[model samples]
Target: MWRNTMNDITLPRASNHLKADALDIGLTEFIEEFGDQLLESLNRSNPPVYAGIDNPARQWVLEGLKRQPFPAQAQVVQAIAALLLDQNEQAGIINAEMGTGKTMMAIALAAVMHGAGYRRTMVIAPPHLVYKWRREILETIPDARVWVLNGPDTLVKLLKLRDQLGDTYDGRQEFFILGRVRMRMGFHWRLAFWQRRAGGGRSLAACPDCGRLLQDQEGNLITAEEFQREERRRRCDHCNAALWTLMRPGKSDGGSRRNTVLKSMCRIPTIGPVRAERLLSDFGEDFLASMLLDNVSEFINLMDAKGNFIFSDRQAKRMERAMANIEFGFGEGGYQPTEFIKRYLPDGCFDLLVVDEGHEYKNSGSAQGQAMGVLAAKARKTVLLTGTLMGGYADDLFYLLFRILTRRMIEDGYQPNARGSMAPAAISFMRDHGVLKDIYTERDGSSHKTAKGKKLSVRTVKAPGFGPKGIHRFVLPFTVFLKLKDIGGNVLPGGVH
Candidate 1:
């Protein structure tokens, strides 16, 4: 006989004298024993940390907690700090209610970590909260150097820090705050122009004196003019119509702005003034604009009027370098600003990652969510601050945990697939802790030819709370839960609710 304690069931071994009834019972018991275990183990894992308050790291956290003004805040900070300071723990969730000063607690934790020798930290927040996080960090840690990785000048700031990529920490504590949108963006070159193409293959230029078109002997438009006899203007040879002098945009006279911008582009080797002009004329403004935003590779091996390659290998390299020099802007590159920093910047650029409103990245398939996942993997440690860690289902936390606590996810045998979807694991998690409903149509007793067929079938799914196994795996060891109401009256001011 075999017994399964987990399911409280027993199964009889195969024997020649076994009765049919006994065999049937054994088969049913075996199915019942193994089925529940399979579902329960999907979202289950050993405690992330075996250490208690007696552990050295916990003691250090307790010591740091004494510095907090409120006892409730101190208690919450101690729990979070313990999880973060523990070597075995990679990530932790602070599910504190709104108005609980979660931001201040996070800052205090950063101070403790900084004092413990972790000098570098990165905070990824919503666009509106970028400055707020910076302010909080400065208010909490006076000596800390905080960098805002958002806004138009982000790329410029990153370029300045290129030399300091490998040296993220230089004794002084540093914090880099970035917005979530920019986390996955990149940089590329773009061109700014004002003239629109004229119709019928003609230039917009006209003779200033007679107000007539300037054409050569072949009837082709004469877009460029040569001055004669010390006079700065050229007269059309056909009708002696004085041609308008082309002046650079924002300038009084002489060169055209289009030509000037082209000239700057030609500084790239092998891309001379002639080829540069041809590029703008051939591709037109719309094509050039699109290429700048999405298809930069189109620049290499560009075709001419005869359909031949325009750029050489050496020239392409130079063009790429020149393109990299320019900063990316809105509608300029088909990537976010943060993506550029993540991809082009060196590895280990940040030592600590702080994600504010972290629950916003619950959808693993979204661009923002995927970007956050990449960023979380790049950092040495991560802290997720959110009011609603799990909206209503166990599946809600799966992707969040997968991104921030990748090692723990891997240890639990759940890995994201090529499409970045952990559907199998999510489904198993939903089955274990999520409420399920089954619905099907049932035939009415009377089969009526004229009456409406059958009643509509409706199924409702409700996931109320995490089961014991789920609480142990996702909540107890990795998360610090707190509510504003739990904080005693001593923490709130006299007028506060």
Candidate 2:
């Protein structure tokens, strides 16, 4: 009986003198009855168990809750942490409603994961929330060394990490907070010339020989260009000093994003030397630099150290418009500050990635979405936190799941093509799950019989929920969803509305 159970087959009731043929028939019937279950058990053993309330990592979640008391939130933190630690399950999602303390929960998970020997965790957030994530990590885990990889100073920060890649930090926990916009950017070197402008304050050009003012024939004030244009060994009319020689010398500064943004901000109305210096001092170089590319409205109501308004409303408006026009060109070795970390930072540098507001990456083809996908692929484990995981479409989850659970996607035969791209797989996924239909429209009211110039349009009218196969393949095994109502007032302070 034991042997039969081990082989997942049954033996018929024993007879005193059983025939060999009868015994063979009984074993065949038993094999047919249990073959599917045996195969299912074997397959289950291959994949790691999904993290649930009963997972061993639940202890870490309980400990974290003790420090920051959120019994209701602890349920989610434990489940996600378990999945992240599981060898087979490297990615999962925490789909909860808004105002449910997703940030706090993510911090708790980071704390637990750090305690469990994972030293590095990176949080990729919206540009506006980069600092907010850093602040939350610090507030939650006071000893955590938080790195903000979001601003003009990000390249410098990445260089520091690259320098220390070979060294060990004795198990010190490090957290890097990055914005989504910078994931695809890279850095390069270029030569930049700093030409001296002849305008504003320093309009007078000094003679090299005697330091006398050099003026043109008009006698108002000699421009630097006019002074340097003289073919002869020019001399000052007043002192006969070498005027042209002094005006032609050039200078340059390394073209860094920090310097470029500072110079650009200084050019805006009411943001002169004094205000620019104050702005840099108040917000730091990175915050000011990021404002040029994202969330410029953050500079609307500027104030001095003494709490006085620096720029009037009209001046602030002008500054906003000016900032919008400031372009960071790649040819000039200019880049968005976040690009340096995304491009040069080593792979697997972050053991865990927490994506806050994961739904924003639903547009799989967008730059930000692609960047998020790249970062997810680099990390060892990923936890996606989102209020709305799906946008009423099966295709919405396609790219997101492909990024988070990359190994699973590949195992399911959704791999990139021969050119090392996933475009074909993405298209196949859309065709399989998305509701696509064709629309025929006549050209300029032409009749149906006159279809020579008719256009056929392929439109995706309804992107409903995923089919059963998709759910079993992409969601059920890895995802853990919790609603506010499920926790109820027993866990929450007051029942969520």
Candidate 3:
């Protein structure tokens, strides 16, 4: 036991030993003396060249913005604007550190782009910051119009937008603040089908009001999967009988229909079970359904039965401004906003799309990423706002870049697969400009007779950080990177830590 323990704890001799004579030499001197080619491989200094922001875009931002930006912040706005304006780039990134006033800078960017003929800007922000964006936009741009597309009335506003398209350019810049959650949110839906007697204790999914099998155009019977669609027509086609129901899913269908609705509607603000029952008794289910399913703007415009102008004034600026947290579940078929915009709104309806916390869209499987990508395609140009643009892995930025720089991505042979993400292209990118490791494991000195005795395996994994080629190709040309160090000394009382 002692011999075995000593053998186990023994140390092996070095294959090559360091010589005492070389101890006095510094690392650089030693490498130069023994391996001189290492000195030749060191890269030369490459500094970032700043773009001049003396153009009209800068003037527009300066003349219009209420709170003037610091010279460095102005530079960030100017640099990003140049990519969209002078260079005509479809997308640009502002990879600035936190506490850099990205909100104020973004408003200024909108002003600059508005001056350059990009009048409509859509900002996809976090839910908590939706109102913040609205407040900043309203305060910064003198006569600008801001819409918060993050509430329960989002669909109503979208419908209103659908109605107001193609109006003559009123020269007023409008900013639409869509919450990331709202952007990817899908509405509650069930395929409208009727119940018909099939005799042997079986009921097929048929039109609720009309007896028709839900089938595809090819005559194939529609599966339950077909009901899970992005955009749905809730009414029946044969007789226009309403096929779909409009209500949030309940815990269980355990009570009478009136009680179910009363219980559900009671959860919303401004109404309790008693008020809900009164509403049900007064308006009936069908009218309420129509209001809940569509025409939410009309509901908010409702007059008090005793004659008040909550009606004259859901348009009331005072009441409206005071109601910030008021939420409702009004929307059209609860379609995902991105899919709705893609199908209904015209291309280029929004002139610019500003993605806040842009790093959130880096995942290949992110629903918001796909939604943002769809919006990017719809908008004329895009500007991504992020603190950490690259999360070490090369593929992290693949889907994001594919969304923003689509034309260039396609030009470079990065196209989407059947599911619409450039996954294969991302793999190819990882191989080309990112690090990947192929690992092999084998059991050498063991002989086994069981079926589970297999011992060799190969696996591949991505390593951290993008390569130089990737930086030069995708990041260097498109990103406006600003650290706190750039503006900290001038803006903050203490220097950047």
Candidate 4:
């Protein structure tokens, strides 16, 4: 039963291949032989404190958590911390099952690392789970500060954070949650250039720096609306300078404050369209905009003209919590968060990166995956949380490992080529750790002048199954597996999802 279940649950491995001296047993016969006691023992947690990490540090991790972890959960938390701190590993994986409290365990791991001097944690989560991540982070570490960077005002918020925040750690565990979709979403852009006259009163778009005539790659003169439909960054052939900047729609308020003010105000928690309109009418645009932009505290503590509190205490608290991590601006430009992180933020600005739904970033074609790679390089350490790591193909992990454990991958000679594409490297990784089938085909009765061998040809393709060496080298060193069964009867409902 155990052998068959392992084959069904995990990706195909070296053990799945035929072996000369392999012993096989059916599930019914094995169950009859082993009985219930052995199975029961397998479905429970083993209590052993992580080595080298003292009880005092463990207690500190536990003290900071709002909800006490079960023994099995605590074991995983400690193991992951030991991997990062003692083992000097760059990544840790949480392979917990669905509905088995994976989010709680990740939050606990963050808390443990927070005690170990990794104070700032960055989370890349699915779009739908951004608020859920914030909720869990606040629930687990009640004192921790969490920011959600998925809303429309993300660029403005990042701009403010860059200007106001200092390089010093503030002693509290801080979390910044960026939605994976928003991290790679396209931003509006336009070419920045000046007009230069080329005799006969004819003018053409010219480079802002070198005054060279701006043209497309084909050498045609550029028009003012050349980028109206699609905009991209291009460099001058001579000056080699960037010719594009983020599109700034509005520089200042244009007297139509009702729509913008009401829109931003309605984004706050518990503020409906009616209240948004009333607030705009009561306090005016500049006052409300300043409150939302500079001081959310004042808005939360706002009183009516009659000196009465506008909202109940509960509403005030909820708004304050939600508003603390968000920023609203009347005329902010759209900027991709990943681009902002790489270009504006300093390296290692975030201590740890906690990637939820980590397997989603494994796709070779996803822009989100490339953006994740950029962030992984920028962050000091990356911990990926995934229910599944591989999709039966070893190449699925090629780009993932190249992103997170880039040094190790480079040491193994899986680096990208000069063109910056890892497609060739991914093929190499697939051929190495995964199964590759060489298909040879020859025509049955085809006859040509030079076809005595029937035109024999071959093509190699990837097959399902990963090599044991790859798992031993890339997976086992960093991963911390936690099955729901391992979590045991005392921890959960004792049923599979």
Best of the candidates, lDDT: 4
TM-score of candidate 2 on Cα atoms, chains taken together: 0.60
lDDT, candidate 4, 313-341, per-residue tens: 99998987776556465554556788998
Candidate closest to the true structure, highest TM-score: 4
Better of 1 and 3 by lDDT: 3
Tens digit per residue, CA lDDT, model 1, 101-139: 788878777766776666678888876566677777776
| Per-residue lDDT of candidate 3, residues 1-497 (tens digit) | 12243213223334466433322334455565767554344322343344463666476656657877877788888888877877888899999998887888888988888877888899999765776788778778869988878755677788889999967778999999998887898867555555544556545456666677666668765544454462666665567787676656544355455555565456555556776777787777656655543334445455656765333442444333433333334333366778879999999999999999999998888899989999999999899999999888888888889889989878878887789656688888899889999999986645567544547889999999788888888898899978777885666666333
TM-score of 3: 0.68
For candidate 4, list the clashing residue pairs, or say none.
none
For all predicted structures, in order, the TM-scores are 0.55, 0.60, 0.68, 0.70
Which portions of model 4 miss their true places by more than 4 Å?
A: 1-56, 163-170, 191-231, 238-242, 245-332, 444-453, 490-497
Q: TM-score rank, highest first?
A: 4, 3, 2, 1
In order, what lDDT does every prediction score? 0.65, 0.68, 0.74, 0.77
RMSD of each: 20.9, 16.4, 9.8, 7.9
Could you tell which candidate, 2 or 3, scores higher by TM-score? Answer: 3
